[model samples]
Target: MNGAANIDQGLGVSIDLRATPKPGSFYRGKRHAGLIDVDQKGAFPVSQYWEPIYHDDTNEIILDPDEFYILASREAVTIPASHAAEMVPFNPLVGEFRCIMRAFSTRLWHE
Candidate 1:
């Protein structure tokens, strides 16, 4: 899903909030969203999007100048056969927080 017009390629802004404690606040199914641009070339307008996380349970909270509020998922999902997914945590220097991808099932696909 990589695109030249993608926001990530326009702002040079990277988010690293994993250091912040998780399950900190008890939210009753509230969603939070924001936007980021990575190009910084001044060629595109502010690229924005909504990132809503389901807040239900309570967990430890970490307060840091570089930390952002923790979020949780609301609904559970299941993948059907011939398809799979991966949940990779965000590494500011490497990937995005909500990065998701399809996984291949070698044996099942061959069978």
Candidate 2:
């Protein structure tokens, strides 16, 4: 897997992604152009998905080679106040817990 990571920090994890987004879902309400905050909710159905590997029965998805996807977390984790934790990598190249430390690092906590 081709990903970006910082070993000292914890790995980034995400549960969902906005892959191949559904065109119909966006054109339904506003009738305007552009995007809405809710559109980023990883709503792409199996039909709109183009990933080479996808689990139709499991609802599990995998991106194609060299493709980027928006990630969503399946669960919530909290680092206690005044405490710092490093994200450990899991599976080396899969799952939501990868690295995307935009606003991450030591501090209060994250959800």
Candidate 3:
């Protein structure tokens, strides 16, 4: 599903991805592992790395499925006054996905 909604100034944009029934495995150097990277210089201190996951039950390490993952840009971006930008996802996984892009004084959010 693709659509657009107005985002008011001073309010942050929010996005939610539907949970998969069976989460896939997330591991570096493994087949079907989810990988992400930021093109903006200095956006990510570490150019490449595995994404972090939080354990919901015992607070122990829980491997997230490879079906989906989230990544954020390390570089902070400032939107000049009177200017707006739109974020569009290229070649994303199929089946009902949404991408939200907002301007921050010095940051970019991706999931």
For lDDT, the strongest prediction is 2
| Tens-digit lDDT string for candidate 2 (68-94) | 443334445555579666656567556
| Candidate 2 TM-score to native | 0.31
TM-score for each candidate, following the candidate numbering: 0.20, 0.31, 0.24
- All models, RMSD in angstroms: 18.8, 12.8, 14.1
Error of 2 at 58 (Å): 4.6
The candidate with the higher TM-score, 1 or 3, is 3
Candidate 1 minimal-lDDT segment of 10 residues: 102-111
Worst 10 residues of 3 by lDDT: 20-29
Q: Which segments of candidate 2 are over 4 A away from where they belong? A: 1-58, 93-97, 101-111
Highest TM-score model number? 2
Clashes of 2: 14
The lowest-lDDT stretch of 10 consecutive residues in candidate 2 is 23-32
